[model samples]
Target: MTGPLAGIRIVELAGIGPAPFACMMLADHGAEVIRIERPGAKKGGPGGDPTKDILQRSRKTIAVDLKSAAGIGVVHNLVASADGFVEGFRPGVTERLGLGPETLLKVTPRLVYGRMTGWGQEGPYAQAAGHDINYIALAGALHAFGRAGDKPTPPINMVGDFGGGAMMLAFGMVSALLHARTTGQGQVIDCAMTDGTALLMSMIWSFQGQGLWRDERGVNLLDSGAHFYDTYVCADGTYVSIGAIEPQFYAVLREKSGLSAEPAFDRQMDPRGWPELKEKLSAVFATRTRDEWCAILEHTDACFAPVLSMAEAPAHPHNVARGTFVELGGVVQPMPAPRYSVTPTVAPRMANEQSDTEALLDGLGYAPDEIAALKAAGAVA
Candidate 1:
């Protein structure tokens, strides 16, 4: 339990996607994360099966019926002993559940309250229900991510849910946590997916301002507008992504891929040459299977790599060398990210949910008989 965040305690309200992932990442890096689950809701149940939801990877899961006064009180008790709390829900739901910041912060004045929502707590659409796609669409992220002539393809919710939602919420919470530790004052983090996604587009907006990019999708330098920056389907129908933006890297890509020392490729940044250069690169790349290309160009200055699937990515040579993935509960899952050399990360043991309701209560200064009474009342599960 003693690593980078040895004394930090975070209580997460049971939810989906980014909330759990942020907690898992936090737990992986040595935060004491206690996930508050609804009573009888099976742990790790999101992967359509309780055992397969690997993202629900860490933390002590305690099912509490928030509708019960005892259960609501339990959260307040936990908050009092916690440095932060993370919850992902539509705006107004937590306040309606009586666990709102206004109420809980009164109990724990120095607790950092982290709220994750698609539209944030005060926006007009804050109360509306939405998923990753809806949030991305509102952020102009969906519009900026497609082929010139093709409909925008969703990027597997990485842009919205995990990147914008969970990660941003975690960041805000941690920032507030650091602040509270120094000043003994708590704050609320209002993390919105729309806001986070827009933040992700800052560089893209810069390109647009210089007229270097089109408002339309896939016509920008990094948005597959240039042939040198796109994926090429090889002979075996697998893809090799090439992103040699610099002239030095592009030169390496051209020479190794056997592209002639042609005028078009030589002029690496010419917008008029993108289509033709892309076509030429496509033809050449098609001559080799992905494997063949990797053998030739991977790890070189070409900035090329075989676009491996999730199953294939774990077993990749470089990734395996780095121990980027680990097998857990009979599933191959990604290892805890952002490593620490001195204070190492540890995998959560057993996928087990262990919270001595009495012990947890005792940590919050509750007596044995008080915890027993709450359990007898069917409040804590």
Candidate 2:
């Protein structure tokens, strides 16, 4: 509770993926986030401990039967004291439960209501079921992946789920919160993964608009098309990434990898020769082990580094030096980023299973008898 968002309070309807991720980010930065789970809902995480679920960490949790009127009342009471709220259900789901934006805004006029979805609140495909892959595919981002001749590859769920969906919702929540604090007028943020994915490709879209980029996969400069801007397998069968996009950086790459005398590399920007140049560069890179090449090219103008895996990334010297990852609740997860200068963030804690239900209700002005009655009636757990 010692970060920039120390005084902020958020109420999150329990969900998977992006919604929980957004709440985790807010909680990591010191927002007091209360997660409401459905009674008897299956616990999620590694094994059965929801606390170990990295995305669910750093928040207090309560279990309530949303079907019960008392449960909706509980949420309304929580909303009255919250600065923001998060939900990831399909459009109209919350409305059916009497917890929609219109209802909550009436309870707290200064609340920022954040809605996360793949399609959005209203659209032709809004009601259709989809995940990260489908959303990014529709956004034109999935079409930009993979090799020149290979079919478009999905870059896991990072692009749509976390990058476009969760992060955008978190930013919207913060921005709307700021606006509310100033103008006393709250707003609803319809954070669509498809829209966010397209926004993420603004640079590439600009390139295409200006006729500087082709509308094909892996044929662009930033894609795997360029010999110097891609990952290469080494003699040891491991990989290293090269990003010598600029002339100076490419010169360093050529010098370090002993390709400086090759005349073919001079046509660096020529797309027609990229395949042949890439083959030649691949052969050169295959001559050395990944670590050997790292020694020659890492920390240089060559813009090179070994392509470390999930198990290897945390141990890398650069990541270790920067504390890019941390161990919490015996779990290794990424640290909260974009370091703050003045109001620094605190270490995150594990998610508890309704450990603070009674306390939260009491704080919300529920008397002891009323809280006991609600529990006895199976409304809150």
Best by TM-score: 2
Model 2: clashing residue pairs?
Answer: none
Candidate 1 per-residue C-alpha lDDT over 1-381 given as tens digits, one digit per residue, 9 for 90 to 100: 646877789999988888887888778778888888787675665544545676666676666789998899888878878888889988878999998888878988898999888898886898899999999999998998889999988998999999988888878877898999899988889999999999988988898899877899777789899888999999999999989999899889888987756766787788888888888888998998999999999779999888999889998989999999888668888887778878888665435554445567677787888878888888885
lDDT per residue as tens, model 2, 260-364: 999999999999999999999999999999989988987899999899999999999999999999987788999887789988886877776556789999999
lDDT of 1 at 311: 83
The candidate 1 region of ten consecutive residues with least summed lDDT is 348-357
Q: Please list the residue runs of candidate 1 whose C-alpha ends up more than 4 Å from where it truly belongs after superposition.
A: 48-50, 353-359, 365-369
lDDT by candidate, in order shown: 0.83, 0.91
Candidate 2's C-alpha runs over 4 A off are: 45-48
Per-model TM-score, in order, reads 0.95, 0.98
